[model samples]
Target chain A: MANILGTNIISSLGFTTEENFQTVKSGISGVKHYDAGTFGLPEAFMASLIDKEKLNDSFSELSIKNSYTGLEKAAILSVFDANKQANIDLSSGKVLFIFSSTKGNVHLLENAVSEQVCLWYSAKQISRFFGNRNTPVVVSNACISGACAQIAAIRALESRKYDNAIVVGADFLSKFIISGFQSFKALSPELCKPFDKDRKGLNLGEAAATVIFGKQNNSRIQLKRGAIRNDANHISAPSRTGEGSYRALKNILQNIDKGQIAFINAHGTATPYNDAMETQAIVRAGLADVPVNSLKAFFGHTLGAAGVLESIILMKALYGNLVLKSLNFSKQNFENKINISTENHFSDKKYFIKLLSGFGGINAALLFEKR
Target chain B: MNFKNSAELTELYRSLQIYYPKFFKMDNLSKLGFLAAEHIFNACTDLQSAPDCTPITSRREPVEPREDIAVICFNRSASLDIDTQYQKTIQDNDNYFPSPSLFVYTLPNIAAGEIAIRNKFLGETSFYVTEEFDAGQMVETVENAFSDTSINAVLLAWIECFERKVEVFMCLVDRNSKKSCIFTEENLKYLAINIKFA
Candidate 1:
């Protein structure tokens, strides 16, 4: 098990994890509708976009001379805040940095195409920002990138390859993404209602979240287990039976008591296929009665940042003895037995599972326990 | 079987008689990786028969969806070739017709997905980006994937395709293989740099 030393999130709701958590607990959503021509898209849509001016001001406060891209700035800001809380020496050779993003510096391709457009270059530049000695590992497995990176950190820590790891997941909204989703007809014109019968589709959002993991720490949160599996079904569509998700859940839930699990944090992008698939997986895993919640309504499916950002929020909620409701969820859409709440409640459990499924038919599950 | 460009890859696919018409829909990057993986899978199971008689598309063996093999690929250009293509579709508002066909292949891991779908591989599928191909890193990643007892074999590769240049070097390493050459940093480096066929 690896200990979670610190966490931070930079999203539309706020700039830190605590702020975002509070905003979520109060049932505030960051998703807002934008008219045509917003972000260079031709149609109107809803998304939770970060304020560029606020981000610039906050990034400038660091007094860094180098001009980093918007995605890099958010990532650095997030890692800076998280490392400040952890107080760990990132420059140490024993520390590893893992950067997770579906697209990094991809917007640069619009006008300029250089070595800087490479994801590895962006990761290396981000690691260099903190004077890290080790080269950063970049994970680009679509939406599962964040969860895969965290799983990599867990294994690295367990294997004693690095004493500590700073994993940051960040992705931004662009015409490239917005247009793609629009073409797929996957964008909902209204606020995304995850797990609700009336749910249409998902809304895009941008955010950067950091999670610091250490092998030796006094932290109470421990990343106990993780598993990644593929359905081998379809690249762009989820499996009808949720085979990969069920196998992932089965792998991590091995030999563990089910009662300790406080709740299941689902991907719940509110896309019809995605929500239905996840429900099938949960039921197949025999955890149908466990209370589940999806943060998409509040975060608007923050792409790569969804895993780390949502994991941090669920960790805090689990430790606080609270179960945050799945916002905007009114009724169950799938014919499975999934216990979803639209109202907050109390839970004294200590364990929680964070599940994420993405393109490429990949599904990942991470089990975290608070001691 | 080293291909220098996409044109040569198409020629290679046509000559190999890979009857899977879905191969036509894949982007250049996916086609390169898919072709490389087909070569490796064929080489392993002795399915590479005469071009005209054997129209091998999918795995000929009747095997269940095996979760024992993992596909881990490293590349310098993470789907930038397709990214640029998708970019052109939405370059301007008047010409803005974002094609979902091109957009879905934007992520690099989709190449691995194509391979998994073709082979029915339910194992872990991951794609990593590095500045350049590093044999040491490739060996390390292969070793890391083995930490999970579920992965019995790993299909490790360094598939790079940016613009006109395309290169793919894939090898399947069975954990229980009693082959002459054991998997090592030196062997991996040598094999990646120099293409030697048995």
Candidate 2:
């Protein structure tokens, strides 16, 4: 089995995995409020905007910020940080780079410079940083892009293809993405309250997360199984019956014992439809009683980075033997009751499930085991 | 649903007698993917032979249906044609209204969703944006999609549209094929560029 050797998160709260994990664990949120000037909104909106000064400060330490785009800077720095901790030689040809991003360098679209708007160019440039030999694989399955990348890496590793896989997901909030969400009327005016009765909508955030997996055991966490299911229900709205997500959960839970699952890290975007669908899905899968939580309250919805960053946090939570609190979860919102942890809880079990559903009626569920 | 190379995709729709109203609302990229998928599915499954028409989802029955086919797609310019349209909506200072119709098709994966829904492929579907048609990356990703034991076949599509030109190559990869050619980068590139391959 491939083991996650190293992980790092470049989020609003902090730059390193340990730093962001500790900040969120301490019940401190990184989400801040900004008005009309930001993203050109007519009204105010809440988002987990990464502190530019803090990022610039940390990036200057690496002294390589100027050469790359803002999104690329975050990704390269996070992967570099993970490599620094794990001592993985990214330059080695034995490593396979799998990059995930919904919209990379898309901010260039405002200038009408259509030539550079391609995600392929951005992916190639990022991989060149490590002097990697193999052509990198870019997954663009909307929000599930990151989780899909890890699954792809696991599959490639099982084929005895590459020695290690550097799975990095990054997306920056440009006027393009923010305006699109605003047009959908999916952005919450206040801090997102996931799994709450008063939950209005989601807040978009930008982040980059990295996980290094090797065949040899170096880290405690192991990815057991993953499944991606399409709803075939609608383009943007998830199935009200949770058909797609339920199927994904059912596929991953086939051989595994339900009792072994300690907690579930849900997508919980705080959007009415998404939150409701997740509730029905968890309950339908018979995982309703499990301690379920969402990290959007801490970092908001980081789009492409949500899956990878949340998975990294899950590894940290499982390694630390704690169920990270689902911040802003106060009241039950759905007809099917779910166990959303209001406060941080302790658990002895070593396995957990990660769930994410995206715009293209896509749903993904992954099972993780810690040794 | 016969497969053939035609510059006029509308002619295929007329020939097939396809009447899905949503097809008209779709952008050129999605229309290309939808048509390519329609032709491939008809060929892979005996659509013409079976008059009653058993869905592709049920044709591979008794072995479970959902994970039977994984849709893997790649593109060069992505949704460049539709993106230009969407950009114009928000670009105009007086209009300032972003048309949700155009906004939805901006991502290339929406075309993949259209294919999955129409074909009823419940398994994994991922879209990769490539600068150019790189056969190596497409072949490697297809191998990864087949890792799941339940994934019996992969509908690999290389759909791209930029300016007025559109190129779509949809190949059905099933291990149960009697006359199936070897799955390789060279074979894919040859088949993609050349429309007619028996």
Candidate 3:
């Protein structure tokens, strides 16, 4: 198992991981009514938008070229944090970069059409910025991209392909993404309420989060076991039986005891199909009694960034010995009995699992333990 | 896993071109995927008997949706349709009815979809996009697939579709072969060397 030295988060909640943790501890809601005149999205008010120009000014002049200012800064900060704990040099040693995002400057497309200026190019641009010319992987598995990115990084590390890996998951609000989600009727007009009986839909948010994984230094968290499985049942819809999600949980449990998992960070999108499917999967995994919380209420749905964004929060919770409430939960939706948090509290257990499901029936589960 | 000759390889490419002309032109990822699928189909003549032909059929046999057959594709350039979709949306006053032409190709793994729908082999399908292709990850994917007794064969390819050009190297690997011979960086280079560019 590779050790997670540290995690850094840059989101609408706050710029740094510490700041974001403080916000989470205080139960501060980062979501707000978005009113950008330039985009002409007045109806879409609630969102978690980062100050792009402000973030760019904080970095070197060369880093501000593309729309990856937030992602670049987050990566540098995470690497810096990891470097402080471990005795490793990134320049001399190989570092596998696994980046997850849904829209890598998809906003750039509205202005012009060029193959050189797409999301994959942006990933290369980041790699070049960090002087990492080795193998860099960009994962875009829709909503599950972030979790999938972590799984890929872990596999790379276990394969001994690199000494350490820098995993980043970032996505920003763009007219392209906003319009797409709205067209699908997946966007919420008001604040998102996960697991709530009256929950309407998700409020789109943007964030960039970075986590460094390597040999266990003095880090507090360790990624024990993880698994990614496909439902193979539907393209846009999740398996009604939650068979895929259940398989992921079952696979992870095969290596580790099911009771060892203290909490669960679910892919609670506040959608009818997604939430119901996840609930059924939890029941099938026999984790119905576990305490689970959905972070989408606070961060909205960051899509590709959700995995890292939620993971960062989970790390902070483990570090601070706290389990934040599920934000908005009125009553249980179905017969599947599971403990959903409605208040901010801490837990004694150290191990937890993060689950994510996306389009094409893609499902992934990651197990994390405090070092 | 080993190819007999370059002529056989050219025939595989020709088959892919005939099936998906638009995708073949869009980038090298699709072209390579098409080629790889054709090679795997031709190599495993016995498994080709059980086809689940549906609306997405391209060949006579339906590609079985079992654990034994897996489609693993890698790409450096992610989405090729985002640019086209963005242009159409902006020009059409951002009216946001997704361009089906662009949306159809937005998925990096739709090449697997094309192959699955055509071949009707619905097994384990996975798509990975890396900054550059990693030999270790490719080998790991193969190892994982082979761990399953049901997955006797695996189709692996490294496909890149960027700018206007496409480059692909695909192969079929089974328990019989100690290592992959059809799809390696060296074999791909060999195939590239044999191409007579006018």
Candidate 4:
């Protein structure tokens, strides 16, 4: 377990964690419709894409422009803002940087697949951007990468080998990603309605989020426990029984009381299979009565950033005694009896669970508690 | 079982006579890792058994479905080999025909998934992409996996397939075993270096 030092999120909704939280709290969505001619795609789509102009303006404020890619810029901006609040020395080898993304510098593939397309190289560049001396760890495990990277940081901090760990998860929309999702027929043409009766597929979004973990003496927030498990069922499809996700939740929830959990922040991507499968896992884990919410309707699925970004928002809500709503959830389509609401609620609970599932039949759970 | 490039992995699979048809659908990186795991798991049959037990050389014996073995793999390229192929399908708008079959293999962890699907071992599987093969990180990662207490063994691997060349060094680390050589950074480096030369 480690202390929650600082956090930041740069997305289409806003720039800082608080800003993005407030935006979602106000029930404002960032999803926009794009025609086939827009963004060089072959079909109409909808996603929460960060404004290139706003990102450039925010990044230009740094005043030291070495010309990094879009993904790199987002990552640097997030890390810089989060470290500013954490007040840690990044140059020290005791501080490790973990970058999580499904694809890094993937846009470079439009020209050729050079060394620049390597995820590790982009991780190194992001690490060196702050003079971090230790080797950066890259987690590219599809959608669960952000949470998996946090678990990595937790393990590293628990080992006492690092004084602090800065985990940043970032990914941007690209023709490569869009076309692939198009091939899978996984894009929603309108704003996604997660867990609703008429819910279609997921919409891709762009964002970069950071969560700093440190072993401090008087830390208020603690990462209680986390687990990652594989279903060993299929590569691209989720398990029919939600085996991996259930195992992950069961492992992390061991010895913990279900009464203290304020809510379960689910990876509700709005896709038919993902939503149904997630509800199955939630109910199977005995969290059927817990208030669950999905932020996909607000920000779309941010891929790697979804885990960390959503965790930050939920943690903030936990501190504020607020249980945010799962926007666009109209009717219960799935058979699971999991609790989901369209309006916000109040809770004085001290603990929350962040759950995510992704490709490769992998599922991850992170438990956070207010100390 | 040494080959100069990844293209010969199909030949290696054929020569080994492993009858898994899904093997052909995997990308080169997954094929390299899948073949290496096939070799390692075949050599040591009783991974969960006592350390003093003799190693079995069974060809097609069905293995038990264990949930304590984790697949912790490291790679340098991180599926760039397949990413490049996926890129070609969508490079030109007029010629865009992105194949979902090819896009599914773009992740490095899918290789671990392929291994897990075949063995039915579902503990904790993760994939880390390092700039290079660092023995210290490998040893640390294996130790970290063991920290979960439920993970009794790890299928540790350093699978790198890029530029048509493949280099894989996979070993099984059983927490309950003491009869074999010790697991250390130096020993891991030695094995990794030897495999590159082999």
Please, what are the lDDT tens digits per residue for candidate 4 over residues B118-178? Answer: 8887788899999788888888878777777677788988888877566788888887642
- Compute the lDDT for candidate 1: 0.86
Q: In candidate 2, what are the lDDT values of residues A1-371, reduced to their tens digit?
A: 46888889998888899999999899998899887767654556788877777777777788744767778878888998998767878888888888898877777766775666787777777788879977888888888988888888898788787889999999888667777787888989888999899999998888999999888776778988898888876778888988878988998898788888889999999999999999999999998889999999899888888889999998899988899899987898577999998888899787899999997788999899988
Span of ten consecutive residues with least summed lDDT in model 1 chain A: A60-69
lDDT of 2 by residue, B1-198 (tens): 232343366777676676667777777777788888777765654422123323453322332234567788998777767767666666644678876677778778888888777766777778888777788778878876776766666788888787745667778776443124488878877876666321
- Per-candidate TM-score, chain A: 0.98, 0.97, 0.93, 0.98
lDDT of 4 by residue, A138-225 (tens): 8888999999999999899888899999999999998888888889988887889888878989988999999989988566668888
Compute the interface RMSD for each candidate structure.
Answer: 0.8, 1.6, 3.7, 0.8
Model 2: docking quality category: medium
How well does each candidate superpose onto the true structure, as a TM-score?
0.95, 0.93, 0.82, 0.96
Model 1 residue A66 lDDT? 57
| Per-residue lDDT over A101-186 for candidate 3, one digit per residue giving the tens place of the 0 to 100 score | 87666665666766444556766766666677765677777778888777766766776757787788888776666666665677
lDDT of 1 by residue, A3-98 (tens): 999999999999999999999999999999999888788899999999989999999999567578899999999999998889999888899999
Model 3 chain A poorest ten-residue lDDT run:
A36-45
- Pick the winner on TM-score between candidates 1 and 3: 1
- In model 1, the clashing pairs are none
Which regions of candidate 3 deviate over 4 angstroms?
A36-45, A60-87, B1-70, B90-96, B99-105, B110-125, B130-154, B159-169, B175-185, B188-198
Candidate 3 A-chain TM? 0.93
Between candidates 1 and 3, which one is better according to lDDT? 1
Off by over 4 Å in 1: B1-7, B46-58, B177-181, B195-198
Superposed model 2: Cα runs more than 4 Å off = B1-11, B46-66, B177-181, B193-198
Q: Write the per-residue lDDT of candidate 3 for residues B81-179, one digit (tens) a residue.
A: 444544466444446464434443556665654554345343545677754556655666566445433445667777665555455657666645525
